[model samples]
Target: MAGSGDAAKEYIAGSAAGVAQVVVGHPFDTVKVKLQAHNTKAHRKLYKNASHCTSRILVEEGIRGLYKGASSSFVGIALESSLFFGTYAHAKQLLQGKYEDGKPQLQVIIPSAACSGALISCILTPTELIKCRMQVQGKDAMHATWYSSPLDCAVKTLQSEGVRGIFRGGLATLFREAIGNAFFFCSYEYSRYWMHSYTDSPRFAGNSNLILAKDVGIGIISGGISGMAFWTTTLPLDVAKTIIQTDPSPLSSRNPLRVLSMVYRRAGLAGCYAGLGPTLARAFPANAAAIVAWEYSAKVLGIRGS
Candidate 1:
């Protein structure tokens, strides 16, 4: 069993990473969600592209519009990341049992990451549902009553659709997280190793020093690349998830695969990856910050064993 102390440290580190991720990425995320949800209708198309969408938000809603659903995101990511990193640490420890060596093989890392992702989905689904709803709504006066706040969104959702409604796209979230995280951790680990090897630096894995520029750079590159890897592979599912969560029609299918099929029929493959541009843009910096924060916080807490 992993020590409670170690688990607590992992949670703290992950929380730091989560905060960093959201602060850096939420604006991009808002744009991505909006693009994914609104671009489906040809007759009612909102924005032509990412830049246009961004400019409109800035002009109409200002910088604050870029972070429209940030409150739910902050809370969701913090809690989900804490549970994910903490769980992954313990799961990897158990899987690696007595190894006490360099990086564990992909076999160990994959299952550990998958398990952590699956568990965190329970927490992630509801919060993401709220965030997506808030993000998809425009700043128009007609939409003012949609959700006054995250709490109000939750209350209204509960009143209208009940508990199951809060977790509308949970199945897609499950597959996305479980599969995406396996890729995420694997890519991160390998990228970190490659960076360490290429630079001939020992600090990439673990460092006793309080701070090092090289180490932070390595973390940024590795985390950013890994994030891109995660989204590139799972974006279709994400598109499905967004549609499922935001569609106002009571008759819209809640099934992710079905949603994807529906989108495929309407707009073909490109439609399924509606928000690819902004997602990739957000993934790099957001995940870079997350890894840098996670590593530094872990070192400070004395929990990074490498």
Candidate 2:
């Protein structure tokens, strides 16, 4: 009974932390995506660096520009992370309770996170679509005069492509979130453990580190490495997803390799990674801070996220 209760608490706490992540880091996410996927031509080669990109966006679009699609992103992150971490926390509890031969198995970890991520994909797709359209609104508005606002985009999608249009890039989004988040949390947990064990830092995984002058540096390093890995793995899919979301048409092919070949032919290798640098820079800090905040929040709520 105690164990089950612990699990339930953890699940609830995870959702709380997820909410924390979105509130703190979403604007950076907005700028990152817009700089990459905006359908603009004047700012085609917009920011020469991550800082430049953000500054340019603010200068051109104002503070609200920095927060474009914020509400949608908030909704998407809140829903997705709630489902994601809630399921993941509960699944971990269930797996721990069901131990193989009375011992927890390490192999099931990946599967648990995978299942959590898949469910989150469904919850996230529509709102994320709204967020995407809003973020990319400023990208050379000439070619993307299709929708007046995020709502219009949603309406147009429903009108033209039906349910699938609203979720035009859902499959890729699913793969991105499921695989990306599975690895994200999994990597985060493992890295935190190794850091706690190896480093001499006080407060290896939380904002509480400020109190300890911490050396839990591994979390940052591990997060960066993992972020890079996850992004690289799904980058091709991301490219495809972006194309489907932003381009005038849905991708006819699902094969990752074929999409790459086509993208290369049409947009070139540079196009494949059109907005990669900002993405990584943005992703690394946003994700790392999110993970740290999430894990710490769970602990504060008396739930063991790991």
Candidate 3:
């Protein structure tokens, strides 16, 4: 009973952090999505050089065009991050059942993190699909006419694809969420722990000002590490997801592994990482700002890191 109550509180904090992150960090995400979703040549032109792309977007689309799908991204990320944090904290608690003295044991932390990652993937699939489509922004795709506002996208996807459409390329997203998220929590907690001890007592379990700085710092560093992890481990899957999301055709019911191999054959290594620079750049501040929001959100929930 007591554990349940604590979980409720933690979820609140997590959700709050997510909301704050959307408010502060979404514009960068907007740019990243544009870069990722652009119809660049897979091995050659998919991602125009960052400077060239930025300049082109500004000159052609104006500032508004650069932020085309921002509304959808903001909404999607808010819900996604909130659910992610809420689940992550509780999952950690569940995995690390009481120690002999009755506290989170911390032994099963990684799996806990993984579970949270997986859960958030399911929750965010619908919004994520919409956001990804909007970010890429092509008129040729079948989904081009489906959205007006964020809600419109969600509704249209539901109506057309049933529950499944909402999860277009969800398998890839699932893998990305689970794997990338695993790295996120692990890096965040471990970093905080390291900062706390800097020597031995790893585990950021107390202190005020230090906790604030540590949480913010942890978020920044962990976000970057998580980005690297996703970039490396799931770049191929991301390529598939991006392709399917933007392509005019539906995700064939074929095995994802098979699909990935096809993409690899067609595009090769360079195709897989078309827009890595902007991705890493966005990951840094988006994550840093999100973490900053998480810390303040924790205080709002009456659980200041200290």
Error of 1 at 20 (Å): 0.3
Q: In model 2, what is the error at residue 303, expressed in angstroms? A: 2.1
Lowest summed-lDDT stretch of 10 residues in model 2? Answer: 35-44
Better of 2 and 3 by TM-score: 3
Q: List TM-score per model, in order.
A: 0.93, 0.78, 0.80
Q: Which residue pairs clash within candidate 1? A: none
lDDT of 2 by residue, 148-218 (tens): 66677778878866887677677877888778766766666666666656664545456654523343255
For residues 1-306, write the lDDT of model 1, one tens digit per residue.
657887899999999999999999999999999889888754456889999999988998999889988999899999999999889888888988756667648878999999999999999999999999988877663332479889999999898889989999999999999999999999998889877767764454455452377778889999999999999999999999999988876577988998999888887888899999999999999999999999989988987733
Best by TM-score: 1
The Cα local distance difference test for each model comes to 0.89, 0.65, 0.62
Q: What is candidate 3's TM-score against the reference?
A: 0.80
Please report, as a residue range, the 10-residue window in candidate 1 with the lowest summed lDDT.
202-211
Residues 1-306 of candidate 3: C-alpha lDDT, one tens digit per residue = 226666666666666666665555455555555555553344545445666776766776677755666676666666677677777766665555554433223466567767877877776666667766665553344344656666776786677668767777778778877777766666666665565455224443465555556656666676556556655666666666766565545556434566667655756665566566666666666666677677667766665533
Question: Among these predicted structures, which one has the highest lDDT?
Answer: 1
Ranking by lDDT: 1, 2, 3
